[model samples]
Target: MAPTAALLLLLSLASVCFPAAAEETLVFVTVLFRHGDRSPVRAYPTDPYQESSWPQGFGQLSQEGMRQHFELGQFLRSRYGNLLNGSYDRHEISVRSTDYDRTLMSAEANLAGLYPPSGGQVFNPSLKWQPIPVHTVPQSEERLLLFPRNDCPRYTQLVNETEHTEEVLNITAEYWDFIEFVNNKTGLKNTGVDSMWGVYDTLFCESRHNMTPPDWVTPDVQQKLRVLKDFSFQIMFGIYKRVEKSRLQGGMLLGEIVKNLSKMAAPDPQQRLKLKMLSAHDTTIAALQSSLNVYSGKQPPYASCHIFELHRDDNGSASVSMFFRNDSGAAPYPVQLPGCPLRCPLEDFVRLTQPSVSQDRDKECQLPSEGRDKEILLILALSAGALLLLIALLLAVVCWRREPMAARGYQHVLNQEGGGDDS
Candidate 1:
């Protein structure tokens, strides 16, 4: 009896420590990462370095950018090797990037590190790389990943309104002198909190490349710019009516991701696709995180990745876990939805995030009065114009009918008689 009791005690301890991990299976993963570092998208008017200074011109990815993505790819391989096959399988994975040179090239460089051509796959002995397709659409048509779309007039109005909020007013008041100083140094006329990101980005790019900034850019000034730059993202995605803003901007992507997760949750005997990789901009990451209400209020660094792992437990219940890999040297940190646990149940996650998602983006993007009021005004204007036209025609007929018989007699009667006798 003592030996049997001891065995039961051992089994209980094992169960407590293991926590049914063996029953859970990792079924699908979605990875969204910012493109690697690049040159300044554009330079300020008074900047010493212009587009001509960079080898590949402005906004192009640099050598360091390629290296950063390559290392990131290697890290992903080490982390996900058990889930992915040793060699690349196109059917099991999909890679997409924004239709830009930097993102496309970053995906390519990352693929090189993730799947170094081996054995029969090696086309050339000298070169260690192989071709892999990265899909993209034209920038104008990209709605899923791009944020703060200008096509949405309501979103534009939201931004304009956000600029006038008390918080924004306070920020403006506090930074007024700093804004003036930056405008003076950068020779920019409009340098407010909303537009200061451009200046910060220019300086950050220059600093990353070891370029010497102007004497005015001390460390303190740089730090201030960085803070404002981060705040700019907040202003665009959060600050006011965040859920509505997300419904227009980031929620589209989130909705698609949730659909993918749902599809994977269904029983499929032929489920070949396991991973989806998206290569996009920092704004994409920020917008999606904001929609999830998991934004850290800091900039997503170059090559930073957000991961979603879906696991199915023994009873066929699926749960999702989120992790953000911001630093290359450190492990990814877990992210919990505002009220959900780190590993949130699939239904709970969908329910919590549904408010952020939009059923019809175009319909939701219309302003409160845009759909009914503007359309009604147009219909009324058209109806009024038509009524006025009809009234004018009737008045002309009345005037002609009211003319005296003598005035209408001679020429009119002669013409009518010449034409026909019925009148």
Candidate 2:
């Protein structure tokens, strides 16, 4: 009896101590990253490099850009090797890029580092690279892969409101003298807040390549310009009602990401795609970060990446985790969404981001009917009056041309009498 009692006690202890271990499985990942470094998009009209100085002309990627993406690919492989297969698998991953040479090439280079050929996958003996397709759409048709889409009138209206904000005004006033100096130095016509980014970009790219900037660009002046440029970027996506701005711009991408995550969380036996990669510009990264409220107020550096990871546990519950890999040498840092845990539950993630996701972007971008009511009414009134006048003119013309039936009969009789006289 004592032995039996001891056995029962041991069984109870085991049941209490060894409750089923919670199983955590990585389900899906979405990565959005800026293209690697490249030549200036365009130089000022008075600048030295112009269009001819660059090897591949304006906006082409440099060799350093290739290296940067390759290293980034290696980092991804190390971080996700367990989740992703060792070799390139088309069914498991999809990559999309903007229709730009730099971005397209960056995707190709990153793939090289992420998946080097092994065993039967090697097509060429000497080269370690294998072709992995990178897809893109024309710039005009691209909406998903880009941000701050110009077609959104609501976003444009928001931008106008942002410009009129007191903060923007103060920044403009603070830099009035600097703007004048830049205008005078560059001989650029009508230089102001709108055109300052061009000057800063030209100078920045030149400085990065060891080219001497103009003497007028003193350290203090450069710092001020940097501040203004940063401010400009902030206002472009942040400042004054950022959430609404996101609904029309960056939130489109986020919405797609959230939808993909939710779909992955569903139980499916044939779910093969493990990763989706987007190769885009610095603005793309900044816009997404702004939507997430994680932007650091500075432009995203070259090859910066934001990662979205979905994890599912054994209990049939799923959660989302986000990480930012802005620095090449360091590990990706975790970022928490506002009003949610760092590893937020999937349902909570969807709910928190739903407000920013627009159901119909075109509808949201349309101008309000109230604002155009008066103009439309005036146009309609003018059209109706013109139509009435046209009808009156037609009636008058028909009346003037009409001949009386009696006059027609009398003419016929006169003709008959004339014929009898002739006979």
Candidate 3:
């Protein structure tokens, strides 16, 4: 009822409703989408889910994929209506994808949704929409884009660092047992299958597109593969800590990122890139997220998006908020930087994502067969095989032990009844 109290209350309400217009802040959105419906990426020679089985041949985005992307574009349109123009502005956004057809097409479908050509937006009247460019690099040339790349300097260096420390290697007899068991069952040479997130990401992408696995892949095999995926995620997170130490720990990348961000925030900011959308496999998302020091222990599902919104307070202090959009959860997951509240300081944000620029990504993200050293990684391979076997045995033991005594008793009773009847 007091005038002073009423005035303070009004001011607080005003700030809540019209907080410093965050409009000046450049919204950087990076979206990672699995390719839409498609045939299997690669079928084993004996695979039943070959190209012929699908309406589209192997690795082509399906109509469902198109709709998913289109809807996503609509979502973007709704979210950033003001930030976007009445028409598509090439300068406002840059799109990139892996060179695979499905990926390229997925990008197109996404663009169709994100930047549907309207009246003048169209190239031809007959067509409802026009082509918006989706950029890509040759798969062979894109080392940083590949998975399980054997030549990641950061990864190699980390291994060396950890290996140098006697305690971290932690090789044990149990490990050898695992290696031997795996070598016996798979018939493949001793190989360390540590980097499986990428393979799983690619496979998951294919499955989402309706690609089927070969009959040779039993349910157990699928489950093991999923475990490998989880392990790969763990490895990814471990590798990131190493990377942070090398690239971002000193606040070097963080500094650069902050500088670029400042430029982007400038009155004459780099209008060259309004929105940057990166369409990559789930591993790519995992890798970046891990580096950002936030690993949720799960791979992002199809069309998962991470958005960084920048804002400036009334006094012109920079801040950022990170949002993750995944399929399963009803709401976006918000992550804030350490020293900041719900929103983080921009300097920290830059520092976190800086590892991407620090490493020679071209060499690190490459496929293993090409970039990997040929020095017969036998010892490690054998050890890995042994470790896998140990894991299998441990899992088996756990399952067997969990069976209740009642279950065994019932089985014994059935066996006795069968034997008596036979006699």
Candidate 4:
């Protein structure tokens, strides 16, 4: 090979392999994380422990959850300390959480670790924490961070179809006995592979809290349940048609994140936000990762975080980097977009993700025209059948009235003939 050609090849490889560290600067960061450890959302009917057994009741954050989010906050501060101001600035950072108590409290706990009361910002000498605003909307109203939105009819149809797929059918058949055993043990009539997660979640939480589970919930049972739980996540977000499922469910959030990144990249002086933190459920992370085609095929652990870092080069070129931190003790894992470089250019990132993001969600969520047309045809057929039945009943009634009139006329003639014979 010519020396010039080799040199050019090296430069091209360098650009793809190395981040433009010297020239690149972090302009904005979006950190999405699952709420930390919490009590079980609910218990099976036959479970020994109920909501009252938990100190904070079911589905609420526990002390350990607080510690986890606090540590995660500290990690975020260390990672983006240079970008974020040392003190809490509402304008510089925005935090949003699901309306659930666990998520809202997790955000608050994280903010404490990210920005402790410093210097003049301290209102009380005894407390090191300062109040930071964490915004939220009702679960029904939230579309940006929630997963498997129930309002989309097409998405629901996809889910129903996914349950009947061969892969799912075989799995369910393989575990039929086990599922029935759980049904008998838990007194849950609706125990199925798709809903096995609730059982696992309840047992896992109990085990974590040192509460003894039933004898049937052995280590092996726990492990198997874990596998099914993870598979449930896949069924919800992938399994049959992942991309289409993502476009309906996770794409909403992905579109919003991209929009924010685009806004940050724009040459707008009013773009003051530096960090956007979202505290949500494991399902949220799973859905987003599925849309990105990077889901790890496991349930997102408590306090697991996904980061989107937007960087700008000295030449004003923008790129996006993704990282997943599932293990608290380990550094975050760098996620390379399937078809893009590790440091994906902003334009390429948007283009590659376009399939997952819906331009018109409601329109796309409607049943296909063919399906709608068939439904209309069925309805019209039923209406026409009903109208014909009504006409047939009216004709039968008119014929019955003529039969009675004919009988009266025959009777009068018979009486007249009998009278003539008597005279």
Candidate 5:
């Protein structure tokens, strides 16, 4: 009501309407992407193009695949130009890939686009690229990058259970005609639902390369096969107890990512890593999406990427945001974790994903004790008891033999005592 009070009120209103912009800083980022296009890993028995037909043999990255990854690198550079150094700094970023040639090469190609040589960093004047280290372990030892690890007996059991699900059975019945057609076309015997994806992959790759597919692979047939392939992909990473599957497979990677995010969120002056990149497979992406409940029920396209960005506000509150870059030409689509906002709080993100993460994947993968194992334990117990009894009997027999010697010694002592009395 007073002049000074009114002015103060107006100032407070302005501050409320337009607060000082909170300083939001990017703290850490993790990007996991499927390797770009490649030749089919293998063809069916009757396929025309075999491994030799591919320039670098089966399952190797194609020229287009290299270009796709390079473009992806460019996209990364554009997106994080401010956060990343103009040239490659080994301490700032770490790149890892599956131990497959395609994935390894894709990472290298991506690095080329992400950190092209500039200024004094150029090793060769003509070449635009500088060698940035990309790390990988052997495929057998790789758990983070590889999804649905075959070594997991529990995962295999889950797959077996999934096979009997009503959905899978119905899909199998629906695709019976297509399966028979593939068998006939490919000259393979007993081609079933599980193996049909191979046929689809071969046909799809051929079609991609402008090679004429077999006459029977008409649009309708191709479409059906595509559906089957997508279904197969779902079965591999989803379809039943998706979160449980993630605990044993994809969740391992997710846990690692969350750990890195949490570490970076902490105020650590020594923290050097700003970016972590993983070059993996489509299944890797699918497993992660399935765990996060963001899967779109289709196979991730080649060079598809899922990004986790960790940001901290001026108040030191941390949040996470996810984006999917499936299409190289377009901007990435924002992916929200189920039950959380687009920019999910770091604590909520970790809590929501806790179910998927495992404390010990290998231990979790151990199958539950079965009747056979119980029976073996019983036998071992019985055997141990019998051995103990046998040892006791042997000790008793030795004691009995010693008793006769003691009796003889007593008789000799009595005879000596009688002789002394007669004397």
Candidate 6:
């Protein structure tokens, strides 16, 4: 009995020290990138390509986008093969996208290459692919799109307050002049679509595809356009001092983005996460990287990815590392996240990313301040009340004056004279 007890005690000790294989692995990722390029998503009034110019309609992903995403999918598979089983594990991964055709379709194309039909997928002899869900919300409805740049009232208020600061107001004035100049030059609608990205996309596409600019575009005008565009892009990215100071003062979107990172990073350090993906536009990435205090002038080229690795150091302390791959470098590509060591501590990672909290807003949003109908109603009510009050006061004054016999007598004399004249 003593010998048997000793063996059981030894077995128990070994079990306590050795963790199960299932619990030993934990990995999570959040990725953001621009859509692969083709034709412009929007057109100036005189752009050569209309809805039907490309094989695909405007704003739809092109063949080039499909190929770009497929390549990305393969890269993901090569990178995460051991962690993922041959079968697609629904619980193991979650994929989300902004509800644009190009973004949604890019996710689909990427998924096809990343997790091709393996076990049951092979059963369909005809080879038609099975459906996989890529969750998305409409752009207008997307909180994620507005992330790190929340549309919340508090954030807007903060931005408004900040905008009044000398730095912000100056930039706003400077950019307005630049915007007007572009409008006059481009002969474009000068409405919502005329941003730095739009201008750059136009020039980039024109130069790449051998398309000539409209007859209105002159050589000097093109140079000026590029210069203004570069400045606008810098301001937009918070690279310029004025923009950086204003935006840093406080912002709704930036606050929300930090909150989101906290949520993702807060998940159990030991919990297993297989695959995570984000489908977003170039601007989306800019917001996220900006939240992390990283921004470059141009939007992250299409399909660029930011990678984070979570691990523990030799001291058995948890740590993290961040990498950005814009695919621009020639030899040693992909920049590391700054302030974070090549392999940073998880605590340090949180500290670096925690600047997002500075953006948290303190107010709610009901509606945009410019509600025309509401303003009209208020104006009408005020006008009617004022007119009624004026009429009443005029009547009261007339009655008071009439109490004096002179006014009454003068009216009577005028009436008699008018009657004689009529006769």
Query: Which has the better TM-score: candidate 5, or candidate 6?
Result: 5
Cα lDDT tens digits for candidate 5, 56-175: 888889889999999999999999998899888999999999999999999999999999999999989999989888899998899888876899888899999998999999999988
User: What CA RMSD would candidate 4 show?
Assistant: 11.2
Quote the positional error of residue 420 for candidate 5 in Å.
26
**Cα error of candidate 1 at position 97, Å:** 0.6
Cα lDDT tens digits, model 4, 324-377, are: 999889999999989999999999999999999999988778878756887899
Q: Write the per-residue lDDT of candidate 3 for residues 1-423, one digit (tens) a residue.
A: 999999999999999998765444545544445555444455433344455666767666667767766776777777777777868888888787878877787778777777777876777878767788888888876543344344455555554454334432343232445434444444435444453333444455556656665454466655655765665455544443545433322123233334556666544454555566656666665655555666576766656776666666545667777777775235667976545576777666655456535544444444356455543476678889999999999976875566555655556556656873222
Candidate structures ordered by TM-score, highest first: 5, 1, 2, 4, 6, 3
Residue-level lDDT of model 6, residues 147-199, one tens digit each, is 43444543444444553656545655656765666666556664321254576
Each model's lDDT comes to 0.90, 0.87, 0.59, 0.91, 0.88, 0.60
Query: After TM-score superposition, what is the CA distance of residue 357 in candidate 3 from its true location, in Å?
Result: 5.8
Backbone clashes in candidate 5 total 0
Off by over 4 Å in 2: 1-21, 369-423
Q: Candidate 2 overall Cα lDDT vs. reference?
A: 0.87
Clashing pairs in 2: none
Give the winner by lDDT.
4
lDDT of 5: 0.88
**TM-scores, each model vs. reference:** 0.86, 0.85, 0.64, 0.83, 0.87, 0.64
For all predictions, the C-alpha RMSD in Å is 6.7, 7.6, 25.4, 11.2, 6.0, 12.4
Ranking, lDDT, top scorer first: 4, 1, 5, 2, 6, 3
Kindly list the per-residue Cα lDDT of model 1 for residues 50-132, writing each as its tens digit: 99999999999999999989998888889889888878889888999999999999999988988888888999999989998
**Model 2: how large is the Cα RMSD against the reference?**
7.6
Clash number for candidate 1: 0
The segments of candidate 5 whose C-alpha lies over 4 angstroms from its true place after superposition are 1-8, 13-21, 370-423
